[model samples]
Target: MCCTNNCINTENPSGNCVKGYGYGKLIDGENIKYINCLEGKCFDQYILVYAENSFKAPQNSLNYSLYYFEIKCKFEREKSSVWMNIGLRNLNTNKYIYYYANNAKIYNEKDEAFNVSINWKNNDYFGCGLVYPPSNMTNKSPYVFFTQNGKEIGEEILLKDNSESYKPFVWLKSLSVEANFGNNLEAKPFKYDISDHLILK
Candidate 1:
């Protein structure tokens, strides 16, 4: 037992630790968020958010009923091999369908990352996340797609389950991204709605 600020004593039960955001349980003071990402490369897992309401777009050209969320490239990866994924996951299964910048997947499944012709870098605002699309819009499949800037840059990906709700899921490798759920994105217009240009009112 020592009596100094630099020394650990009975009076100090909490040490120096930084609690981060994620799905992983709290340990010591660090957070283990990545469910299936490369360690030392992927990081920063936070709570997913979505807009759940029936509303109209800022303009009268679009009107829809559904829930969704989006993400933007806040930072680039340190390595060339590292990329980012913006996905939606089944709350129950925890499995997700995600997007990549320069890659694709043969099948749409959990933890699968697909490319969308997006060179996600600084100032690149990507809106590649959606929770639940109408059964018809989804083609009876649960899968979705990704978007770049203000327009979608990829094709329709498939999913196994469209029944369960989804949450925002991100996979970052040597990169960083920011998630937005229509809270304060006037500067970053949705660019394009994931619902295939919702029926105009």
Candidate 2:
């Protein structure tokens, strides 16, 4: 799904919004065009943007017992210390788990951090994947994983809460990022080989 146009903190009539405090403009239906903040000490604020629709996987597939939704994104410009957060947020609970690009860590809704020791640079391709086991597999649990430039990074993190209300989201600061939600593989192929993870029926 494409990003929704209803941006946050973009209604500065005086054109004096603090630098790095507002959402970037969405361009070409998938890319987030960077908006330069006013000249001053950069005010650090994360602009949260959600996709146009929630992701849903096909249910009850015997051969494909695990299902996953992945988002591939490239860091176009890295103008700030803290770059961005890419992950999934539960619509009902409002809880989120994201990969923090600055410190190479993962963070949950409680502000807890998990160190993954993977550094990224400008123009590097990175992404997050949410994998869920089949409903019939009671022993299995849902988890989150990271990928960089067509390769998996770190380990798969299992979620404590098994709710399936999660949706893809991104928190941006002063960064220009291009995201692909795997809506059409032919148009924008994912950097990671997602077909190896789960087969979508």
**Which candidate number would show the highest TM-score if scored against the true structure?**
2
Q: Mind giving the per-residue lDDT tens digits that candidate 1 earns over 1-201?
A: 111342222243233213321222222321112232345534433323222332221222122344455655544334454455566655556665666554543225544444444455565766554333343443433345566767766676654533355655555543444555665457755666655634432
What is candidate 2's lDDT per residue for 116-200, written digit by digit as tens? 8677766768777776666676676667777877888776777666456678877776666778777787998888887665753
**Every candidate's lDDT:** 0.45, 0.64
Error of 2 at 67 (Å): 6.7
C-alpha lDDT of residue 125 in model 1: 65
Sliding window of 10 residues with minimal summed lDDT for model 1: 23-32
TM-scores, all models, native as reference: 0.53, 0.75
Model 2: lowest-lDDT 10 consecutive positions: 10-19
Error of 2 at 109 (Å): 5.2
Reference-based lDDT, residue 123, model 2: 72
Root mean square deviation (Cα) for candidate 2: 5.4
Total clashing residue pairs per candidate? 2, 0
